[model samples]
Target: MKSFSDKLLWGIIVLLAAAMAITAAVKLSPLLNPPQDISLPLNAACDLHQGPCTTSLPGGGRLEFSLEPRPIPVLRPLRLQVRATGIKADSVEVDFAGVDMKMAFNRPRLVSGKEGLFTGEATLPVCVRNKMAWQATVLVEADGQRIAVPFRFETKR
Candidate 1:
């Protein structure tokens, strides 16, 4: 036979254990089986000199990408800017990579500026060849979801 206080203490301990177990399961479920990501292709042909290029995002939103200075020079400071519309984003980052070659360290996290605009500075690495193709992947985080938009272009020396 147990006292009333002992029974109440045991009951509280059981409830707390149950709550912790539920929290752990919710956090680990994603690691157990990750969700598949969908890639959205930009329809517009982006030329570095022309002006800012626009693209439609998945769901309902728009993304505008631009770079300062035409013909994108290597080993120099380049300004990368993005303007997003009809979307709520907490943060934005650009991941720069070579189309064919492997570039391990070029991704720079952009800081938000003004309204719906994010800007960052990044430098492209010089390749052995005079010409190289690069991809700038913009990652937007909104409402606990991350979306990636890729812009491809070629550079020449």
Candidate 2:
């Protein structure tokens, strides 16, 4: 026995409540389960062994990675230097893996050398193929959040 206006008011209230609920979910969903993998495209033509290569990071930061010994060699110690700008990181680590092969287990924690500079030593394993593609994933931890930046490069025998 509700009047027409009363029914219309109830309908509007229901719609408003539903809209608010959807908005809340959209805002809080990321916090509930933050993204784990964030793929960053190479903004520049980078030769990892030749010189320094830079990539843009989230939150207006820049990540630069350089490998020592101009041409990267397999089964040899390689020096990796990481430089970060405009971002504060508590710790940084590098994970090296084969791009097309199932080769893992090369995560090395870098030591801080100077302000915003991290250095570490890692070696690339030889693959069956004469030329192999590798990905170096740099994990930066700050403020209880982990950001992964991957850099892809190729090596030949």
Candidate 3:
């Protein structure tokens, strides 16, 4: 009778282990399969000159802007960085609002040993007292393709 009860207990444990294994497999099956891709429409557009200080693509490109203070009071300089893939431009330019400043940057190139990555920077004049927002844009022309990115910025008064 004791042997029979011991066998029953081991059988119950084995069954429970099998059930847990099946449950785990079912829960994880979705992860093992390829996910579906979702697409969205492009709303408005960015021109050679126009929105935010920084604009990022849905894919993997990003544009960043930074402000650097100059030695002279009330004068601020801006530094812009762009990292992108699959796009190349002949030139890039930036324009500031409420200030008569137009700065240009050279074309972007891949950092060594990396593919599809580009970076460049430009400096522009800014006023801290004015606290006005600024506008910037990027134009890329390569392989008969033209892409423009617009940006806006605001500095403290």
Best by TM-score: 1
- In angstroms, give how far residue 17 of model 3 lies from its true place: 95
As a TM-score, model 3 comes out at 0.37
Per-residue lDDT for 36-155 in model 3, tens only?
Answer: 232222223432123223455444554433233322122433334444453443433332333334333322322222343234434444443555544544443334544555444444
**Could you tell me which 10 consecutive residues in candidate 2 have the lowest summed lDDT?**
30-39
Each candidate structure's TM-score, on Cα atoms with residue i matched to residue i, is 0.73, 0.71, 0.37
Better of 1 and 2 by TM-score: 1
**How much lDDT does candidate 2 score?**
0.81
Q: Which of 1 and 2 is the better model by lDDT? A: 2
Give model 2's TM-score versus the native structure: 0.71
RMSD of each: 10.5, 11.4, 18.9
Q: Clash pairs of candidate 3?
A: 52-152
lDDT scores in order: 0.80, 0.81, 0.42
- Lowest summed-lDDT stretch of 10 residues in model 1? 30-39
List pairs with backbone clashes in candidate 1: none
